[model samples]
Target chain A: MLSVESLSCRYGGVVALRQISLTIAAGEFVALIGANGAGKTTLLRAISGLTPPYEGRVIFNGQPIERASCAQIVRAGIAHCPEERKIWPHITVQEHLRLGAFGRKDTKEVARDIDRVYAIFPKVLERRKQVCGTLSGGEQQMVAIGRALMSRPKLLMLDEPNLGLAPLVVEQVIDVIRAIHRDGTSILMVEQSAALALPHADRAFVLENGSIAKQGRARDLLQDPDVKRAYLGEEKQGRLIQDPLAKDPLATTR
Target chain B: MLDLLPQFVFNGLLIGMSYALVAIGMTMIFGIMNIANFAHGEFYMLGGCITYFIAAKLNAPYLVAVPVSVAVVTGLGFLLERVVFRQLRLKSAMSSVLATIGLGLILQNGALIFFGPQPQAIPTSFSAFPLQLGPIFTTEARLFAVAVTAATLVLMYVFLNHTLYGTAMRATFQQTEAAALVAIPIDRMRGITFALGAGLAALGGALLGAIFFVQPAMGATESLKAFIVVILGGLGSIPGSIVGGIFLGVAESLGTVVSSAYKDAIGFVLVIIIMLYRPDGLFKKS
Candidate 1:
């Protein structure tokens, strides 16, 4: 239930996003794959109202959110777990989850949602009292996802969820993303790792130079010769889908 | 002669608590909103002026005057946040510095024109009585300021740690963008912070007016003391502000006994020495 129409954004002299249009129905897991400087993160930032768009509009649940404040956009049911896992250093793990539900008024429902988040990431539950700054990279990613879940958003936008993590940790995070999608939250995940994301995403869009290069069923995109050659490296040619434990798609052509 | 050491220490601590009261709000503003708030001292002056107007001019009771002063300054602070500080937030860092300095000058001069240049005392109810705790001697006014400061600080600590809004405030301070994702109204949180800081500063001014004197220029000295306290504690650190205030107070008191002429210099000396060893302030690691 999210519609982004002809959205364009610029950072001073550079055009970060140009007339990009996309949509996500309720309960769909969508992935946006791209190389560095492909404007994947910028698209997410524009939709979340963190960056003002120079053209076009964003509609969520049939209401225009192009001019809304970042907080208002969140209240309207889109939670963005941004890049670098920007968790407050001094806050405890439990407090991070609590903040995720800051928009809600019902304490009982909020508490239940927190339990739901913890169920998805038990490591976060174990580190309830520990400050987030002390958490490991994977655990921090868990906290970021858990924090997004606390918002109970209709759509969750994740930027580089698998970045800078150990292989084992990446697998676990991918599993958590799958579990979250299975539980009925629409996800728009941006990743350089097409190998990890395409397998989990129901549909995918390949972004290049601030525009969509390809969009289709994830299964078809994985088998496409161009996508495979460009995104899924040659060394792991046949092993892309065969090995569920394959290493993440390397940052191709960075 | 040694028995008097406790007396000096106690006095230092009492004044230190007053400094803490003013510094608490300043630190919170800096922590969450990243505003140095040069006009913070003007809010203190406004509080004292309001109290003087209520208690002395209108002949109201001290109890009635104190809360009214705090409420008035708090409203003013909220207005400032909405009308001025919020806009400054989008501009460069120098905008906040310039806006606050300009606001401080306006408020200070406005007070000077309205209240005149003469120092006015609130004629506190507690000023008539002096309290003695064993060998230590103190006025009831000083005790009231210390007790209220301690109680307010403890309440602030609880609010920051225990409440949902408090947790949100802490989150906003740490990561503004993340806080927004959770639907914490960033602007609203900042306004609330501004109001609270102003209220605390007003309370300090009202209480200090009873012990010291209230003039248009009083905020200058008090805000300077608060700056010293904030720097000594560490910028944007609550615990740091408290410890720094007490340290400055004790140092000044002890230094005064040695040389009253150099008593004021004690805080500056301590700040310099503390910064040399721990540039982040005494309380914060960095």
Candidate 2:
């Protein structure tokens, strides 16, 4: 369980996240949907301690971790699979999995967990010896998710796991995510595609311009007219807006 | 000329091993920390000076002096990394370059003040008598230096390829953010890497110091050769540094047949050619 209370973050002079608040109960699948540069990635970075917040408290379980280092945050059971699948290009898939459990002292359990990851992604096992740069986008995405699981995390934060992925691959990844959630690992996913994220999440928070615009049950938000119009592209003219906030320079810069 | 070929090759191999040792350290620091440590050779110089102080002045055995000197320099490296280079990490690459250059000047002057301007030799138990090996001939001290360099390189290879810490270092070199997310203490890694790099260079200085004279200015040429080797080999490739070092050594050795006065120019020439044709160096990492 994690709670972010009235968090405000800035990148130099630009306010990336402005007094945002959200929470995830144990084993709950929560989605944060926002347009590009809506501070989705920054929120995850702030929570993981990559970017220190200017104000607010990030309480993980019962402990406040606002000033913890990235390594400390990871050791405390939060594994962040960052945007664009930041896997090392030259490192092998197996090595990536090994690196994921770097904080653990149990070598035997680490080895067992690696095999568990292979079982989850058989394709990753087949390409275990190969460098990640040589793998296809789908295989790389699988490796990224499998790598996140290697930490045995209590809370997994995935930032755009489906970015630049194919439709079929996205479906497979989402299916795996659902199964992982079913197994009681809480997930905090940031997705730009509202239609894709809403159905899979138990609850959702719609972020707009660094602030939480809407928060409710995923099923309720699915049928909300404004949510449908703004996010799902259900305009009166039946023409998709692509990105309604595309004109915002702040949106594009992030 | 043909009768002297083996001797030339033997001499080249000896110098080449020393060059490889120094260049490998330089390359590792460049690869992992992204710092072109201009003060790297000062570690080598300090190693020699410390070994001289222990073996000649303190009356310690040469074997004992070498490791002690290396450890001292390595400790100094760790201290400098913590106090100096760590702060520069947040600054620009140019800032680090300037800082290291200034550090080099300070170290060079510090050695000059402490050790004096005159070159000094490390007293060793090994005989200076030339040992005959088929067609090649070398002194005991030179042979010992070569043997030590070979063993150190083998150990370095094992550490980098087989150990968990080495793998973590390589992973950090490849992706800093991804490495941190996995709970690798990157700051600690940087400190250890800097220390290890300095230790390797110090080992080279200790071994070579026994064979040749140690002086404050010795580091300047050694550092320049290391930079040349790193550029010729590929900026951060360890194997590249080794091969480049040997090639430069052999080329210089052979250059003596034409004109011994310009033998040192061969390395600079080869580096220019490498830059013109293969700007990425001989072994570009994938």
Candidate 3:
């Protein structure tokens, strides 16, 4: 379980996240839905200790980890598969998984965990010897997820897992996400698509302008009028609308 | 010219071995920390000086002195990383470079004060007679240097490719933030890498000291050659450094055949032309 209290972060003078508080219970699936620059990625980065929070605190499994370095935070059992995937270009898929288990001392279990990841992602297993840079976007995403799982993390924080993928590829990844949740790993996913996220997550929070705008059961928020308008692109009449004339319909209501 | 080719190539390999040793260290530091350590040459100097003090002053055995010199230089390198480079690593890359230049100055001057301004050499345990095999010719010290360097390179390759820490290092070298997220203890990795690099530089200096003078300014020329090798090979690549070193050495040897007076200039001229054509260096795809 993870608890973030009044978290605030900035990029120079620009505020990326402001006074946001949230939590995830053990084995719970939580989705954070927001448009671009809504501080979704910033919040995940702060929690993972990639960028130290400018203000507020994060407590993970009863320990205050706001002051911890990225390595320390990882050792405390949180793995972040960051935005852009950040996979090493020349390294093999198998090496990425091996690096993921860097902190673990148990060789046998590490091998077992790698097998578990391979079982979940047979594509990654097939391309184990291939360089990551040469893999397709969807395969690379699988490798990123597999790499995160190699850490055997207590809580997996994913940033924009569906970003830049085709609908079919997105569906495949969403299936993997669902399977991961069903296996009892707590997950906090940041997404730009409420339709993709809300239907899957048990609990969801809507982030707007660096603040928590709404929080409720995923199903309830799915029907919330404001949530529907801002995220789901649905009319109050319970119908999905697509406007051909509107340029950049996915753009945030800034 | 054909008969003289073997001798030139033999000479090139001997000098190339020392360059390989020094360049490998410089390449390692660049790979992991993303810093061009201007102070690396000073570490090479420190290695020779330490070997001299142990072998000449204390009358220790050659074997004892070499390892001790390496150990001392490595410890100093770790200390430097902790006290100086670690802090600078957080700042701009230029800051680290400037800091290393400053460190190099201090180290060079410190050696001047401690060892005095004399050019010293480790007393060789080998005969002055040139070892000959058909058309090839070399000294015992040169052969020893080449043998030791080859062994060191082999061991280094094993450490980097086969070990857990090495895998972590390679991961860190590739993407530092991601490596940290996997709990690689990046600071420790950097420290170990710095120490290993420094140790190797010292080993190179110790080996070369038998054949050449170990002077305060020796590192100035040696480090320059090492940098040239790194650039020739492609920055931060280990195997590239080795091949680049040999290439540079052979080029220099061959260049001397044409005009001994401008041998160094010949090597530099060739490097510039190669770099202009492929700025990424010989090993890189670009």
The best candidate by DockQ is: 1
lDDT string, candidate 3, B148-232, tens digits: 9899999998887778777678778878888888888889999999999999999999988888878887787778888999998
Identify the CAPRI category of the predicted complex in candidate 3: medium
Model 1 ranges off by over 4 Å: A233-254
Global lDDT of each candidate: 0.87, 0.87, 0.86
DockQ-based CAPRI category assigned to the predicted complex of candidate 2: medium
Q: Please give the RMSD to the true structure for each candidate, in Å.
A: 3.0, 4.0, 3.4
> lDDT tens digits, residues A78-128, model 3?
999988788877678988898899888898999898899999999889999
TM-score (0 to 1) for chain A, all models?
0.92, 0.92, 0.92
lDDT of 3 at B183: 83
Q: In candidate 1, what are the lDDT values of residues A1-254, reduced to their tens digit?
A: 99999999999878999899999999999999988889999999999988989899899999999999887888889999999899998899999988888888888998998888888888889999999999999999999999988878889999998777777788898888888888888999998867778988889999999999999999999998878876786556532323344454343222
Q: Model 3: number of clashes?
A: 0
* DockQ per model, Cα: 0.79, 0.71, 0.70
**TM-score of every model?**
0.94, 0.93, 0.94
- Show model 2 residue runs off by greater than 4 Å: A233-254
The weakest ten consecutive residues by lDDT in model 3 chain A span A245-254
lDDT of 2 by residue, A234-254 (tens): 563322234444442111111
Clashing pairs in 3: none
